[model samples]
Target: MPEIRFRPKYISFDCYGTLIHFQMREAVEPFLIGRLSPDELDRFIAVFRTYRFDEILEYAPYDQVLESSYRRTCRRFGLDAEAAAIEAITTAVLNWGPHPDVPGPLAKMAEHFPLVILSNSDDRHLAASVPRLGAPFHAVFSAEQAGAYKPRLQAFEYMFNALDAAPEDFLHISSHQRYDIIPAYDLGIRNKVYLDRGYDPELPPYEYFSARTLADVNTALGI
Candidate 1:
């Protein structure tokens, strides 16, 4: 076993990009078909992600966030946004499985620590995704439960309150700087792990251990 540096009271995670294969760009690309060049589609995906993040600044359903962001992206690119496309996007999320690296190592961690999830997702969608993770979670929290999304202090606050725990009691792991890691650090969660999924930049000021995969995190924890 590796040296155990920290043993948290609970191990919390950001579900989407960290554990689950967040395939937003993959899911939306087909909709862009002939409307955008390859380079423009990449920009379109980035802008759509921005809109989704912006939409969640305040309380709203994840569906609304997706719909509004998708429409805004299409409108920005002068393309037509259709209801079917919105429906397809939402459906795709329901069917997404965990990243190939998640299950085995997550299960190993779960053996020694209570695992939890604080996701920027709806209960229905989260429900569909959790069982696919191949591990038992102590608690699974969603934006629907918190009435807020990641990067928002309210979401983290809600998780802290629900667990009746303080920020110091948990090890929060995530791939997103703006969405999960930064807010967590600001909220005084000293122990954080950045699962570098390549979607966001790494900022060392936050003082987090970086891992390329869940197995790396498990090894770091001495599991």
Candidate 2:
């Protein structure tokens, strides 16, 4: 067991990338086939990612956010955005399962503390994703309920209000610095874990620990 700053009331998480196998690239790649040259594919996907981030800045259904972003990105490259393509992306999200390293460590932690998720997901999509995670969660919150997404203070505020717990009561984990940890830090959640999945850069000033996987987090928590 390694030293940790605090023992939390709940082990909270940003589900999609931290635990769930987020396969956005895999899901959207087929749609771009022949529409973009091989070199253009990466650039287009990057733009799509940016639009996705932008879409989540304000309140909207996750499906609508996806649709808006997808359409905008497609239009930027002169490709026709189809309704079926939007549906395909939203449907693909439900099929994502946990990362291979998640379940055992999560189960171990669940013995000592309740597990919670504050995901940028629709309620129905969250329902589909949670059961596939193999470990039980004490609570799962969605953007649909909160009217906001990760990195937005409103989302965290809604989650905090719903859990009836203050920022100090939980240890939040995420792979995304911008989308989860950074906002969490700004909101005064000091006990956080940077699940270093390489999706984002690590900023030490935030004062959170780093873990390669949930297993590392389990060890850090002295489980």
Candidate 3:
């Protein structure tokens, strides 16, 4: 848990899955229908997620990463990857809104600390999703601007450079430890909050406070 009186100069967030409802699974589900049984489908989705993370290890356009990962997963299952479906998935991603619990507490936090976003998606997708969070951001950084993604040091490095701030100066909030907390911790961001969306386990070694909603994060920050 965070220190009782702790407050950061800036509160940074991992946009997708943490704030915005990540609907990648929903977007990809239609394409996989009829191709595999229920059990196989679950395994396929898990592998597809791994492939997407692997594809982002090197800098590339987000759409290209999605396309290549989707193709790889389809081919592994002996199914064809449809070009049109990739476009459809990208469109679906751009249209995703915040999770149900986001707006109120996030808005409250915005009133106290300057809020920022460090997201994996590009500027265009963020342009659509950020507004739906019902709070104004101090700044927003995207993988496209950084030329890198989370779990990679370059992405967080870009944010630090852009803000002209050190990691200790900020409090980071994210749901996925693998994508956000782990990398942020490595970069020396000590004040962290893991909003438990259940994508990953709460890792105590990383030294982050765990909460199930933004409301809990708001309370932790004393906002």
Candidate 2 local distance difference test against the native: 0.89
lDDT of 3 at 11: 92
User: Model 2 over residues 92-194: C-alpha lDDT tens digits?
Assistant: 9989898999888888888889999999989998888888888888999999888889888999999889889999998999999989888999999989999
Which model is ahead, 1 or 2, in terms of lDDT?
1
Q: For residues 22-138, could you state the per-residue lDDT of candidate 3 as single tens digits?
A: 888899888888878989899889999999999999988888899999999988888888888889987898888999999999999899999999999899989888999999999
Residue-wise lDDT of candidate 1 within 19-67, one digit each (tens)? Answer: 9999998889988878899999989999999999899998788888899
lDDT of 3 at 101: 98
**After superposition, which runs of candidate 2 have C-alpha atoms over 4 Å from their true positions?**
none
Candidate maximizing lDDT: 1
All candidates: CA RMSD (Å): 1.4, 1.4, 1.1
Candidate 1 global lDDT: 0.92
Candidate 3, which segments miss by more than 4 Å at Cα?
1-3
RMSD of 3: 1.1
